[model samples]
Target: MTTPLGGAPLTSLEQDPAMAGGDADSGDAGDLGPQPVVNRTIGRRHGHHGRNWMGHGRRAKSNPELRGGFDGLNFHDQRYANGGNQFSVEPPDQGLCVGNGFVMESVNDVLAVYDKSGNELVGPVDLNTFYGYPAAINRSTGAYGPSITDPSCYYDSDTRRWFQVVLTLDRVGTTSSLAGTNHLDIAVSQTANPTGAWNIYHLPVQNNGTQGTPDHGCDGGFCLGDYPHIGADNNAIFLTTNEFALFGSGFYGAQIYAISKKALVHGAASPNVVLFNGGDPNIPAPAFTVWPATSPDGQFAGARGGTEYLLSSDAVFYDSGTSNTLWLWSVSNTRAIDKAPTALNLDVSPLTVQDYAVPTSLVQQKPGDTPLRDCFALTGCAPTYLGYPNIVYPTPRPMAVNDSRMQQVTYANGKLWGTLDTDVLLADGTHGSGINYFVINPHSGGLFANGTLALPDANLTYGAAAVTRSGRGVIAFTVVGPDNYPSAGYASFDAKIGAGDVHIAAAGAGPWDGFTGIPYLAGNRPRWGDYGAAATDGDRIWTASEYIAQTCTLTDYLTAPMFQCGGTRGALGNWATRISKFEL
Candidate 1:
């Protein structure tokens, strides 16, 4: 069974291509002529609170229309391998930060706090509770959350604070059904210690002219701020997101918010925020996810009255046709947010570089589907795992390598660096998935250096990079193909020398056996992690990526462990995450 790219599961309300700006291939924002949007909003301080502990999210079944996969298996996730009630969600998007002795990481909805020595300080807390919201799976009362996805956190040494952001959809009361309204919940730690009290601010992006959000015209309905990211300078904190219709149609450009970092650090009531709308998702050359660059040293470029740089890709799928154009965007006069009259400006210009196209879905090699002859002979899966009714062979699914969008961007060594998933020519001259790592001088808007790292047989996808003050860094991504399972990998880079050879940080134990890609009827595409993360400490860089940690035979999966597959993975999926730090 082969699942088309768009065949991945979607919610019943806004699943139509016509309604959600089509799939990765269809939303070609044709020629968005360089018109920078300028807008402003005065966001009120929602409140500040603390909930250091997080209980497990309930696995109760909700609206099947909101989730997808093999539900008959009673897996929390069905189609797209998305978990409805349980915390066993798919595509462990890695969001991490390492600074001031604390290593903070958030995968999907679970947040884990670790010390610099790799000790788990705070283990597996749900984001709902972290944000002062009601727990999704309340152990005592058995209540749960609406829907929270795409989490990002930053440890700013400039202000000695920890910032965490996530995209949250409005829930209908305390139940599982969605309320069709959404906002960005930004939390700031009062002290350097992240487990302490946190101040929370709510920035609504529905833009239907409600909830203090300006009317940006979201297909005549509320908009969803999908994939919110974080970046900061000495003056402010930048949060960017891709706006999509919550209940209606069309995909808008990237929505950018510039918040006063000082105000948040000082615990001021009602910090100022300037909103930059992506402008008309249906118009020509619509912007996708424009990623903001995080600064590690707190040393920012002192040009154009303090600047916060960003990078974006118009490769094939995002531009409708093939494109080699990379857009360089910046927010000038960012310091003006503190004054009564703000002079913030959004500048978007294109820089030509290596041509890139939509990449192929990653393939994996695992011992899942054996010969039917062996099963009939009772020598293989006939006795335990598959012999049972409703149990079937768990064939490795094709990892969903979503559209070619910009990955993490960072500022270091007076240069802006970033990554993007794109088609590359391998040593064999065949097209394969790889990353285009790039560097820019933000001042002159120049493409200083770049390289496309690819393997002869293996495909590299979901690139994440972090650079120190001296241009020492690593580009982290996942390696998978006909010969390799899903594994965590990285490459070293220096300003003098480009990216080095690919090194396996942690080898995958098995192939991708998640529910999203199981071969049932028209087989589905297992979505790989949507994002990968890397952060800098002093001379070391830390990275977290999705990899298969263990594999079990059919017989061992169903019985003794009571369907947890030897407690190596979730009950339904075979995905795990690995974090590794390299001392340069």
Candidate 2:
């Protein structure tokens, strides 16, 4: 078993005797320099491994079969199988692959499980049949009331059990849609063996529910919140009470919500829970929960929250051009989330510099625009320059992470490897076109390397889908080509190398390749859901279309061709589309 750093303990920066002094820029925040990466793996690991068995890819060539029977001819809108986003857990040793599954349209959308092997653990079982989605939403406001939906799965080595925390929506009918009467469901199961029975139990919130409104903004509509994240800490599932924010519009705010292990999941409700709520105008109403570690120096210290919730700031509110920053809160324990002085508190302390005066990548200079520095590698390509973050310092910097984006600022391998979107620097250097890739250390806010890939003139922006980190490399992709045309999803790549390691080639420069034949996925499309597909896991090597699910071997990705959200009939109505899984 991969043990957590420092026994996975929780420590507060506020409680740290040595870390008490200095501002975020004091340059003394615990040697934020790049240290060798100890754990080669990223994110939580999983268990329960068996042999491999191949299964034929779903062969239905029609859209009806691809879209789970929804063909857009009728208003066959199916609410989220459980009103929550998908849950994922990667195996420790076999960190190369991860397991991800969601509550789908069955048994009232009971949660299901899919691991690295692409086998369904829950295998056609309704999550509700085992647990239940007991919460509701507020009709007028579209706010979610209490009853867990934020389901997070973790492997417990101590008991060999999988722990899940359901974050219940707190407002009845507050956010009504086909996605089940707006509720959260956190259930626990011990499914170590694929063919074994699960010991499933639904966890509960204190006082039988939440105390505040559905956390919908006063104006309502798009400015609403949902999607809670739960983590293990202090022997409890540490939850954040932050609002779930709508993306692109870029708004943020949420607090810590906690649930105890002894309560609900263990069949008892004790010690009222408390939730943190923050007030800010530019930002939407804070989500009712945020994941918090009791202390900063503890094991959970320097660890980033795996999930986020936010209130959409731009949709309902008029011309708030500013992208709202999602505020976060934390709960020390589940049972005391709503009742303790320390339960719901802000995670950012020492008043870290709110504005680092850092320019968005859209306004930064390109590495090529400057001189070649750092390390560089070349193929048949021309000799180029490689840069490093302008400076190096030690202070925790604010980086937003979500299902849409996985941002990390860590010191590893004795060289600070900062990774972020290339678009942030394009507008200033390259007219915001082509592949945008950069490496900048967050601690010092320095620009290490900034440049575009030598693609065959593909206008790349953040449209390149998702960005994820592997061993010592960074991978990002986007749907590149004309905005209106069925563009190709191009994957940009780069990796850090050790000096003593093989200097087979230059560092940043390499032969550019493509994951050819990645056709534009045309199916059920939503305004935002269709924007870009999410990567299967943190490896970020490949991103699968939302409509497609692969077979057991990860050889091919399959889906329906007629996947449409609001548009009229087409493939979104009845055609299935499958694509070969090829690396770029």
Query: Please, what are the lDDT tens digits per residue for candidate 1 over residues 1-584?
Result: 11112122222221111111212222122212211111111111111111111111112133221111100011121112222333445666678888888888886666778777667787556677678776544434445565667889898988889999998776667654467678888889989998778999888888878888887777647777878999987789999987766655556677889999889999888899998876644333446678998877687766777889888876543323346778888888877879941698888878877766666444445444322212323443333333321334435445666446789998899998988876655555445577777888777777778767777667788889998888888888888866778787788766666677777776777777654333221123346778988887777788887777676664455445333555555434666777777777
C-alpha lDDT score of every prediction, in listed order: 0.65, 0.25
lDDT of 2 at 323: 20
lDDT of 2 at 64: 20
Error of 2 at 122 (Å): 3.6
Candidate 1: regions farther than 4 A off = 1-85, 137-143, 280-285, 316-321, 366-395, 426-430, 518-523
TM-score leader: 1
Q: Model 2 lDDT vs. the true structure?
A: 0.25
Cα shift from native, residue 483, model 1 (Å) = 2.0
Per-residue lDDT of model 2, residues 1-584, tens digit only = 11212122111110111111211110111223321111011111111021111111111122121111110101111122233221111000000112232211111123344443334445333233345333233223334333332233443322333454443333323332222123334544434332344444322222212333344342222222343444444335544433422211223444344455444344443523444454344433332223222211112322232211111111112121112132222222232333453543333211111111111111111121001111111221111111112321111111111111212222222222222222212221322223223343333334444433323222322222222333233332222221111122333333332111110000111111110010111111101111122222333232221121111110111112111222211111111111112222
Candidate 1 — worst ten consecutive residues by lDDT sum? 65-74
